[model samples]
Target: MPAISDAKILIIATDGFEQDELFGPRERLLAAGAQVVLASPGGDPIQGMVQDQKGDTITPDILLDAVDIEEYDALVIPGGVANPDTLRTIDAAIEIVRGFDDAGKPIAAICHGPWLLVEADIVEDRTVTSWPSVRTDLENAGAIVVDRSVVVDDNLITSRKPDDVPDFTDALIRLVEEAEVDA
Candidate 1:
Protein backbone atom coordinates (compact mmCIF):
# COMPACT_ATOMS: atom_id res chain seq x y z
CA MET A 1 0.00 0.00 0.00
CA PRO A 2 1.07 3.53 -0.65
CA ALA A 3 1.88 5.71 2.33
CA ILE A 4 -0.57 8.29 3.64
CA SER A 5 1.94 10.79 2.29
CA ASP A 6 0.79 9.79 -1.16
CA ALA A 7 -2.89 10.39 -0.48
CA LYS A 8 -4.46 13.39 -2.16
CA ILE A 9 -7.53 14.45 -0.22
CA LEU A 10 -10.04 17.02 -1.40
CA ILE A 11 -12.03 19.22 0.98
CA ILE A 12 -15.01 21.29 -0.21
CA ALA A 13 -16.32 24.07 1.96
CA THR A 14 -17.36 27.70 1.90
CA ASP A 15 -18.31 30.62 4.11
CA GLY A 16 -19.73 29.57 7.48
CA PHE A 17 -18.22 26.10 7.56
CA GLU A 18 -17.94 24.88 11.12
CA GLN A 19 -14.43 26.04 12.02
CA ASP A 20 -13.16 22.88 13.67
CA GLU A 21 -14.87 20.49 11.29
CA LEU A 22 -12.83 21.79 8.37
CA PHE A 23 -9.60 22.70 10.10
CA GLY A 24 -9.35 19.69 12.40
CA PRO A 25 -9.39 17.16 9.61
CA ARG A 26 -7.38 19.29 7.26
CA GLU A 27 -4.66 19.90 9.84
CA ARG A 28 -4.52 16.27 10.95
CA LEU A 29 -4.55 14.97 7.41
CA LEU A 30 -1.72 17.27 6.41
CA ALA A 31 0.22 16.28 9.52
CA ALA A 32 -0.20 12.67 8.47
CA GLY A 33 1.44 13.63 5.19
CA ALA A 34 -1.62 13.74 2.97
CA GLN A 35 -2.17 16.48 0.46
CA VAL A 36 -5.34 18.35 1.46
CA VAL A 37 -6.79 20.52 -1.28
CA LEU A 38 -9.64 22.92 -0.63
CA ALA A 39 -12.20 23.81 -3.27
CA SER A 40 -14.64 26.68 -3.07
CA PRO A 41 -17.35 28.01 -5.37
CA GLY A 42 -15.20 30.92 -6.50
CA GLY A 43 -11.72 29.85 -5.37
CA ASP A 44 -11.69 32.65 -2.86
CA PRO A 45 -11.09 32.72 0.86
CA ILE A 46 -14.10 31.57 2.88
CA GLN A 47 -15.23 32.28 6.39
CA GLY A 48 -15.72 29.78 9.22
CA MET A 49 -17.98 29.58 12.24
CA VAL A 50 -17.67 28.31 15.77
CA GLN A 51 -21.19 27.41 16.70
CA ASP A 52 -23.12 30.68 16.24
CA GLN A 53 -20.00 32.84 16.27
CA LYS A 54 -17.73 33.75 13.42
CA GLY A 55 -14.35 32.05 13.47
CA ASP A 56 -11.40 32.07 11.07
CA THR A 57 -11.23 31.92 7.29
CA ILE A 58 -9.36 29.90 4.69
CA THR A 59 -8.50 30.35 1.05
CA PRO A 60 -9.48 27.70 -1.45
CA ASP A 61 -6.92 25.92 -3.54
CA ILE A 62 -9.23 25.75 -6.54
CA LEU A 63 -12.67 26.62 -7.82
CA LEU A 64 -15.49 24.09 -7.52
CA ASP A 65 -15.67 23.84 -11.31
CA ALA A 66 -12.01 22.92 -11.47
CA VAL A 67 -12.15 19.87 -9.22
CA ASP A 68 -11.11 16.65 -10.96
CA ILE A 69 -12.33 13.57 -9.15
CA GLU A 70 -9.60 11.50 -10.73
CA GLU A 71 -6.96 13.55 -8.93
CA TYR A 72 -8.03 12.83 -5.39
CA ASP A 73 -8.15 9.82 -3.10
CA ALA A 74 -10.88 11.02 -0.77
CA LEU A 75 -13.36 13.86 -0.17
CA VAL A 76 -14.14 15.78 3.03
CA ILE A 77 -17.21 17.94 3.60
CA PRO A 78 -17.34 20.15 6.68
CA GLY A 79 -20.63 21.35 8.05
CA GLY A 80 -22.12 24.44 9.65
CA VAL A 81 -25.63 25.87 9.56
CA ALA A 82 -24.84 27.84 6.45
CA ASN A 83 -22.07 25.93 4.70
CA PRO A 84 -23.91 22.89 3.39
CA ASP A 85 -27.22 24.72 3.25
CA THR A 86 -25.73 27.16 0.80
CA LEU A 87 -23.71 24.54 -1.05
CA ARG A 88 -26.60 22.12 -1.56
CA THR A 89 -28.17 24.63 -3.90
CA ILE A 90 -25.05 24.93 -6.01
CA ASP A 91 -24.96 22.60 -8.99
CA ALA A 92 -21.19 22.47 -9.05
CA ALA A 93 -20.95 21.48 -5.39
CA ILE A 94 -23.58 18.77 -5.64
CA GLU A 95 -21.96 17.47 -8.78
CA ILE A 96 -18.62 17.32 -6.99
CA VAL A 97 -20.17 15.18 -4.25
CA ARG A 98 -21.77 12.94 -6.91
CA GLY A 99 -18.50 12.72 -8.76
CA PHE A 100 -16.65 11.57 -5.65
CA ASP A 101 -19.33 8.99 -4.93
CA ASP A 102 -19.40 7.78 -8.52
CA ALA A 103 -15.64 7.34 -8.39
CA GLY A 104 -16.04 5.16 -5.27
CA LYS A 105 -13.79 7.49 -3.26
CA PRO A 106 -13.98 7.77 0.49
CA ILE A 107 -16.36 10.62 1.42
CA ALA A 108 -16.14 11.92 4.99
CA ALA A 109 -18.88 14.33 5.98
CA ILE A 110 -19.55 15.71 9.43
CA CYS A 111 -22.53 17.41 11.10
CA HIS A 112 -24.76 19.19 8.58
CA GLY A 113 -22.36 18.34 5.80
CA PRO A 114 -24.43 15.28 4.92
CA TRP A 115 -27.03 17.58 3.45
CA LEU A 116 -24.87 17.69 0.36
CA LEU A 117 -25.02 13.91 0.22
CA VAL A 118 -28.78 14.10 0.38
CA GLU A 119 -28.72 16.72 -2.34
CA ALA A 120 -26.48 14.46 -4.39
CA ASP A 121 -29.01 11.63 -3.96
CA ILE A 122 -26.34 9.11 -2.93
CA VAL A 123 -27.43 8.31 0.63
CA GLU A 124 -30.08 5.78 -0.25
CA ASP A 125 -29.66 2.44 1.53
CA ARG A 126 -26.50 3.65 3.27
CA THR A 127 -25.86 3.94 6.99
CA VAL A 128 -24.78 7.35 8.35
CA THR A 129 -24.64 9.68 11.35
CA SER A 130 -25.08 13.41 11.49
CA TRP A 131 -26.08 16.23 13.82
CA PRO A 132 -29.53 15.85 15.37
CA SER A 133 -31.19 18.35 13.10
CA VAL A 134 -30.07 16.46 10.00
CA ARG A 135 -31.13 13.01 11.18
CA THR A 136 -34.68 13.29 9.86
CA ASP A 137 -33.36 14.34 6.48
CA LEU A 138 -31.01 11.36 6.37
CA GLU A 139 -33.85 9.02 7.26
CA ASN A 140 -35.92 10.63 4.56
CA ALA A 141 -33.08 10.04 2.16
CA GLY A 142 -33.27 6.30 2.95
CA ALA A 143 -30.14 6.25 5.12
CA ILE A 144 -30.08 4.19 8.27
CA VAL A 145 -29.41 7.02 10.67
CA VAL A 146 -27.41 6.10 13.73
CA ASP A 147 -26.27 7.96 16.84
CA ARG A 148 -22.53 7.60 17.07
CA SER A 149 -19.29 9.51 16.89
CA VAL A 150 -18.53 7.87 13.59
CA VAL A 151 -20.27 5.63 11.06
CA VAL A 152 -18.68 3.90 8.11
CA ASP A 153 -20.62 2.20 5.38
CA ASP A 154 -18.85 1.22 2.20
CA ASN A 155 -17.07 4.31 0.89
CA LEU A 156 -18.87 6.80 3.09
CA ILE A 157 -17.66 8.02 6.49
CA THR A 158 -19.79 10.29 8.68
CA SER A 159 -19.73 11.81 12.14
CA ARG A 160 -22.18 13.73 14.28
CA LYS A 161 -20.52 17.03 15.18
CA PRO A 162 -17.35 19.01 15.74
CA ASP A 163 -16.50 17.01 18.86
CA ASP A 164 -16.31 13.93 16.68
CA VAL A 165 -13.57 15.34 14.47
CA PRO A 166 -10.81 13.10 15.81
CA ASP A 167 -12.75 9.88 15.32
CA PHE A 168 -14.01 11.19 12.05
CA THR A 169 -10.56 12.04 10.77
CA ASP A 170 -9.17 8.71 11.95
CA ALA A 171 -11.84 6.78 10.12
CA LEU A 172 -11.27 8.81 6.98
CA ILE A 173 -7.50 8.35 7.00
CA ARG A 174 -7.87 4.64 7.55
CA LEU A 175 -10.32 4.39 4.70
CA VAL A 176 -7.96 6.24 2.39
CA GLU A 177 -5.06 4.00 3.35
CA GLU A 178 -7.19 0.88 3.02
CA ALA A 179 -8.31 1.91 -0.43
CA GLU A 180 -4.68 2.28 -1.29
CA VAL A 181 -4.08 -1.36 -0.33
CA ASP A 182 -7.01 -2.43 -2.46
CA ALA A 183 -5.78 -0.40 -5.38
Candidate 2:
Protein backbone atom coordinates (compact mmCIF):
# COMPACT_ATOMS: atom_id res chain seq x y z
CA MET A 1 0.00 0.00 0.00
CA PRO A 2 1.17 3.52 -0.69
CA ALA A 3 1.90 5.86 2.17
CA ILE A 4 -1.05 8.18 2.68
CA SER A 5 1.44 10.60 4.27
CA ASP A 6 2.43 11.84 0.84
CA ALA A 7 -1.13 12.60 -0.27
CA LYS A 8 -2.52 16.09 -0.30
CA ILE A 9 -6.30 16.31 0.04
CA LEU A 10 -8.58 19.18 -0.80
CA ILE A 11 -11.75 19.66 1.21
CA ILE A 12 -14.41 21.91 -0.35
CA ALA A 13 -17.09 23.30 1.89
CA THR A 14 -18.82 26.48 3.03
CA ASP A 15 -21.16 27.77 5.68
CA GLY A 16 -23.70 25.26 6.98
CA PHE A 17 -21.50 22.27 6.28
CA GLU A 18 -22.05 19.38 8.66
CA GLN A 19 -19.44 19.63 11.38
CA ASP A 20 -18.67 15.94 11.50
CA GLU A 21 -18.83 15.38 7.77
CA LEU A 22 -16.06 17.92 7.24
CA PHE A 23 -14.09 17.52 10.45
CA GLY A 24 -14.48 13.79 10.97
CA PRO A 25 -13.16 12.66 7.59
CA ARG A 26 -10.54 15.41 7.63
CA GLU A 27 -9.34 14.40 11.08
CA ARG A 28 -9.16 10.78 10.03
CA LEU A 29 -7.32 11.64 6.81
CA LEU A 30 -4.83 13.70 8.78
CA ALA A 31 -4.32 10.87 11.24
CA ALA A 32 -3.73 8.50 8.35
CA GLY A 33 -0.81 10.80 7.38
CA ALA A 34 -2.36 12.82 4.58
CA GLN A 35 -2.03 16.58 4.26
CA VAL A 36 -5.47 18.21 4.09
CA VAL A 37 -6.47 21.73 3.18
CA LEU A 38 -9.82 23.48 3.52
CA ALA A 39 -10.99 25.62 0.62
CA SER A 40 -14.10 27.70 0.83
CA PRO A 41 -15.46 30.39 -1.50
CA GLY A 42 -13.58 33.11 0.35
CA GLY A 43 -10.73 33.63 2.75
CA ASP A 44 -13.04 34.28 5.69
CA PRO A 45 -13.69 31.61 8.26
CA ILE A 46 -16.66 29.41 7.50
CA GLN A 47 -19.24 28.17 9.98
CA GLY A 48 -20.33 24.56 10.38
CA MET A 49 -23.69 23.16 11.27
CA VAL A 50 -24.78 20.13 13.26
CA GLN A 51 -27.87 18.95 11.44
CA ASP A 52 -29.73 22.23 10.90
CA GLN A 53 -28.36 23.94 13.97
CA LYS A 54 -25.34 26.19 14.30
CA GLY A 55 -21.97 24.63 15.10
CA ASP A 56 -18.29 25.46 14.90
CA THR A 57 -16.48 27.90 12.64
CA ILE A 58 -13.53 26.76 10.50
CA THR A 59 -10.93 28.96 8.89
CA PRO A 60 -10.22 27.92 5.36
CA ASP A 61 -6.64 27.24 4.29
CA ILE A 62 -7.31 28.71 0.86
CA LEU A 63 -10.08 30.27 -1.18
CA LEU A 64 -12.06 27.85 -3.26
CA ASP A 65 -11.47 29.87 -6.46
CA ALA A 66 -7.78 30.04 -5.67
CA VAL A 67 -7.19 26.33 -5.22
CA ASP A 68 -5.43 24.47 -8.01
CA ILE A 69 -7.31 21.23 -8.37
CA GLU A 70 -4.34 19.61 -10.06
CA GLU A 71 -2.25 20.08 -6.95
CA TYR A 72 -4.45 17.84 -4.82
CA ASP A 73 -4.64 14.10 -4.98
CA ALA A 74 -8.28 13.87 -3.93
CA LEU A 75 -11.37 15.97 -3.40
CA VAL A 76 -13.61 15.69 -0.36
CA ILE A 77 -17.05 17.27 -0.31
CA PRO A 78 -18.81 17.38 3.04
CA GLY A 79 -22.58 17.48 3.13
CA GLY A 80 -24.89 19.97 4.78
CA VAL A 81 -28.21 21.12 3.33
CA ALA A 82 -27.20 24.68 2.71
CA ASN A 83 -23.61 23.91 1.97
CA PRO A 84 -24.13 21.76 -1.10
CA ASP A 85 -27.20 23.65 -2.16
CA THR A 86 -25.17 26.80 -2.40
CA LEU A 87 -22.14 25.10 -3.87
CA ARG A 88 -24.07 23.52 -6.69
CA THR A 89 -24.93 26.97 -7.97
CA ILE A 90 -21.34 28.06 -8.30
CA ASP A 91 -19.89 27.48 -11.77
CA ALA A 92 -16.36 27.18 -10.43
CA ALA A 93 -17.43 24.53 -7.98
CA ILE A 94 -19.07 22.51 -10.71
CA GLU A 95 -16.00 22.89 -12.89
CA ILE A 96 -13.67 21.75 -10.17
CA VAL A 97 -15.88 18.73 -9.53
CA ARG A 98 -15.85 17.85 -13.23
CA GLY A 99 -12.10 18.27 -13.40
CA PHE A 100 -11.67 15.83 -10.56
CA ASP A 101 -14.10 13.38 -12.09
CA ASP A 102 -12.52 13.59 -15.50
CA ALA A 103 -9.09 13.04 -13.99
CA GLY A 104 -10.38 9.85 -12.36
CA LYS A 105 -9.17 11.08 -9.02
CA PRO A 106 -10.93 9.92 -5.89
CA ILE A 107 -13.88 12.20 -5.20
CA ALA A 108 -15.52 11.52 -1.86
CA ALA A 109 -18.90 12.94 -1.03
CA ILE A 110 -20.89 12.42 2.15
CA CYS A 111 -24.42 13.52 3.04
CA HIS A 112 -25.65 16.36 0.85
CA GLY A 113 -22.21 16.82 -0.63
CA PRO A 114 -23.16 14.68 -3.60
CA TRP A 115 -25.38 17.47 -4.79
CA LEU A 116 -22.39 19.10 -6.36
CA LEU A 117 -21.56 15.89 -8.19
CA VAL A 118 -25.02 15.74 -9.62
CA GLU A 119 -24.73 19.34 -10.71
CA ALA A 120 -21.42 18.57 -12.33
CA ASP A 121 -23.10 15.78 -14.32
CA ILE A 122 -20.48 13.24 -13.25
CA VAL A 123 -22.57 10.84 -11.17
CA GLU A 124 -24.36 9.18 -14.04
CA ASP A 125 -24.18 5.39 -14.01
CA ARG A 126 -22.05 5.43 -10.85
CA THR A 127 -23.18 3.81 -7.63
CA VAL A 128 -23.27 6.10 -4.62
CA THR A 129 -25.00 6.80 -1.33
CA SER A 130 -25.91 10.02 0.39
CA TRP A 131 -28.25 11.50 2.95
CA PRO A 132 -31.77 10.09 2.59
CA SER A 133 -33.09 13.33 1.17
CA VAL A 134 -30.33 13.56 -1.41
CA ARG A 135 -30.74 9.98 -2.61
CA THR A 136 -33.56 10.93 -4.93
CA ASP A 137 -31.42 13.62 -6.49
CA LEU A 138 -28.66 11.14 -7.19
CA GLU A 139 -31.13 8.65 -8.61
CA ASN A 140 -32.58 11.30 -10.85
CA ALA A 141 -29.11 12.11 -12.07
CA GLY A 142 -28.63 8.54 -13.35
CA ALA A 143 -26.65 7.24 -10.39
CA ILE A 144 -27.30 3.91 -8.76
CA VAL A 145 -28.35 4.93 -5.29
CA VAL A 146 -27.75 2.66 -2.34
CA ASP A 147 -28.42 2.76 1.39
CA ARG A 148 -24.97 1.73 2.52
CA SER A 149 -22.52 3.44 4.85
CA VAL A 150 -19.91 3.74 2.11
CA VAL A 151 -20.00 2.96 -1.60
CA VAL A 152 -16.93 3.08 -3.81
CA ASP A 153 -17.75 3.29 -7.50
CA ASP A 154 -14.56 3.56 -9.43
CA ASN A 155 -12.97 6.85 -8.38
CA LEU A 156 -16.07 8.08 -6.62
CA ILE A 157 -16.72 7.34 -2.94
CA THR A 158 -19.79 8.26 -0.96
CA SER A 159 -21.40 7.74 2.43
CA ARG A 160 -24.86 8.41 3.75
CA LYS A 161 -24.37 10.57 6.80
CA PRO A 162 -22.23 11.58 9.72
CA ASP A 163 -22.78 8.20 11.36
CA ASP A 164 -20.87 6.67 8.48
CA VAL A 165 -17.84 8.89 8.91
CA PRO A 166 -15.48 6.16 10.12
CA ASP A 167 -16.15 3.82 7.22
CA PHE A 168 -16.36 6.67 4.77
CA THR A 169 -13.00 8.09 5.78
CA ASP A 170 -11.39 4.69 5.86
CA ALA A 171 -12.48 4.04 2.31
CA LEU A 172 -11.03 7.36 1.12
CA ILE A 173 -7.73 6.77 2.89
CA ARG A 174 -7.52 3.34 1.32
CA LEU A 175 -8.16 4.82 -2.11
CA VAL A 176 -5.40 7.38 -1.66
CA GLU A 177 -3.05 4.68 -0.40
CA GLU A 178 -3.97 2.48 -3.34
CA ALA A 179 -3.41 5.31 -5.79
CA GLU A 180 0.16 5.66 -4.58
CA VAL A 181 0.68 2.00 -5.40
CA ASP A 182 -0.76 2.53 -8.87
CA ALA A 183 1.44 5.58 -9.34
Task: List per-prediction Cα lDDT, in the order shown.
Answer: 0.95, 0.92
Tens digits of per-residue lDDT, candidate 1, 95-181, equal 999999998999999999999999999999999999999999999999999999999999999999999999999999889999999
Model 2, 78-128: lDDT tens digits are 998999999999888888899998888999999999999999999899999
Q: After superposition, how far is residue 15 of candidate 1 from its true place, in Å?
A: 0.4
Cα deviation of 80 in candidate 1 (Å)? Answer: 0.6
In terms of lDDT, the poorest run of 10 residues in model 2 is: 174-183
Per model, how many backbone clashes are there? 0, 0
Candidate 1: stretches off by over 4 Å: none
Please report the candidate that would top TM-score against the real structure: 1
Per-candidate TM-scores read 0.98, 0.97
Question: Which residue pairs clash in candidate 1?
Answer: none
